[model samples]
Target: MRPLEGHHAIVTGGGSGIGAAIARTLAAQGARLTLVGRRAAPIEALAHALHGTAVTADVTDRAQVDAALAHARAANGPVTILINNAGAAESTPFARIDAAGWRRMMAINLDAVFHCTQAALPDLRAASAGRIVTVASTAALKGYAYTAAYAAAKHGVLGLTRSLALELAGTSVTVNAVCPGFTDTAIVAEAAANIARISGRTPDAARAELARFNPQGRLITPEEVAASVLWLCLPDSGSITGQAIAIAGGEVM
Candidate 1:
């Protein structure tokens, strides 16, 4: 039988990129999935393809999160696995960072995790084995130029994950963070395009510049990130909480 055959999962930001990959991976393991995202069309299409549910909610809004959870519960039962994958990143020089940008970063990256986890906590606790996986980033583990706001927000996510892991110790729940670097996603493609515009480099050269951050000199695949998340959700991984597993090809180590 599949490891997650009987579990129900809620994956935030499940419309595309890493979230979409994780949702597909979990579904393959037989977890009943609810793909939650701000945009309904993408997640709805994916959910139909995967035989899962799709919920539209702005994770930063508490009421929206609660409503989404309610809908998910009705469709797939209580959530035994919660993937806090909804987040955004921005690159602005410290001197140029404004209050609006800082707040936006924190709202999506850190605040959303808090809201979603709280909403899902009861369901997670009721399960024999529960998992909460947050998709953070390499910025959470270290510093980066022109990304002070983004880095700070991601760092807060890691801090929250560690604290909750310990707070829920002795329970059936496990909380952890997966941090990937220079991933080959739409976000990275936009960054590469921006680099090309700013530096007059070819698109391929711009992408290579971002990939150079990893010692392997390649972008991390969404499938690779999904694999890590799947491993954490396995029942055998109950003891593996409070970890910031870096999927950055030794870049953070």
Candidate 2:
């Protein structure tokens, strides 16, 4: 039998990148999926391809989150697995960081996690087993230059994951964070382009600069992060709560 057969999962930011990859993986394992994102088109296309439901809602907004969950429940039943994969990152020096930028980072990276988790908690508790995985970043574990706001928000995500893991101890629910480093996604591509503009280097060179952080000397793939998330959601992984699993190719260690 498939590991996730008959489970219902909600994946935030499921339109593309890591969230889309995770959604695909979970669906292949037989889970019914709800793809949630701020934009409907991308997720709707993905959901159509995957035979899942697409929900349009901004995770940062509590009302939208609640409405999305209600829609998801109506479409796919109660969520048994929650992947808090909706996030954004901005690169700005500490000195230049504005209040709006800082709050935006926190809203998408940290607040979205809070709102989604709370909205799904009841369904998770009622499930035979529940798994909550947040796609945090290596920034959550260590500092990154010109990303103070992003780093701080990711750090908050890790803290929230740890706290909830402990708070839900002894229950069937497991909460954890997957921290990836310099993933090769559109976000990184944009960052590389920004670096190219600032440093007058080719985009490839700018990408290489970021990849140097990983011992493997390559950016992590979205599928690799999805694999880690899949593992955490397995029935055998009930004891793995509260941990921050790094998929950074040894960057953190």
Candidate 3:
């Protein structure tokens, strides 16, 4: 609808799955984009296909994130919309969760959000109006049996979301988070694999286990999450800040 016409957007982890969907959806709404990811291949491919810019950087690295955002601002415009969609999750038993795992999870999921949001705050403030959407998971709102670390990190993301919303209260910038349940993405596939290995069940069975968590008996699609994000970026959505809308087919309820 060109609601975002003349705007520039930065989507972390825009290489595939929900991130890619968000990138394409924003592009469709007439926003020029800068896609960021650790790997260059997918971002390059997406940038080429969608006529967007691409940057390869690990979001956890403050220097790298600053460089990427600088490149994005130089190539496009001040980032008016930012989607903190880059995250990683691994199912580990509470007792077996190693220090490295915990640090890595927090680095990519929590620290990355902090770094990128801080890096983009000046531009967003300069714009006088901006949107910051973080793609958290339903785990942020509830505890999962074997996903303590992941859930904790996502909870941190939501905390940032709400706190930023309050901090920017009365400002034109709106901050919100979308919590999706059992989304059909590589993250789910990794979860399925872990479940299979741990529980000695077939991958199909583990996958089904996650699907059953959704009342619809199906995984939510990336496009669906993207649509929700697009909604938040609309001019009329300024009043939606500090909300964590769940796309879980009634599962969260």
TM per prediction: 0.99, 0.99, 0.97
Candidate 1 at residue 226, lDDT? Answer: 99
Off by over 4 Å in 3: none
Candidates 2 and 3 compared: the better one by lDDT is: 2
lDDT of 1 at 161: 96
Superposed Cα deviation of residue 137, candidate 3 (Å): 0.3
Clashes of each: 0, 0, 0
Off by over 4 Å in 1: none
Model 3, span 35-136: residue lDDT tens: 999999999999999899999999999999999999999999899999999998887789999999999889998999999999999888777569999999
Instruction: Tell me the TM-score of model 2.
Output: 0.99
Q: What would the per-residue lDDT of candidate 2 be over residues 17-89, giving only the tens digit for each residue?
A: 9999999999999999999999999999999999999999999999999999999999989899999999998
The TM-score of predicted model 1 comes to: 0.99
Worst 10 residues of 1 by lDDT: 244-253
User: Who is ahead in lDDT, 1 or 3?
Assistant: 1
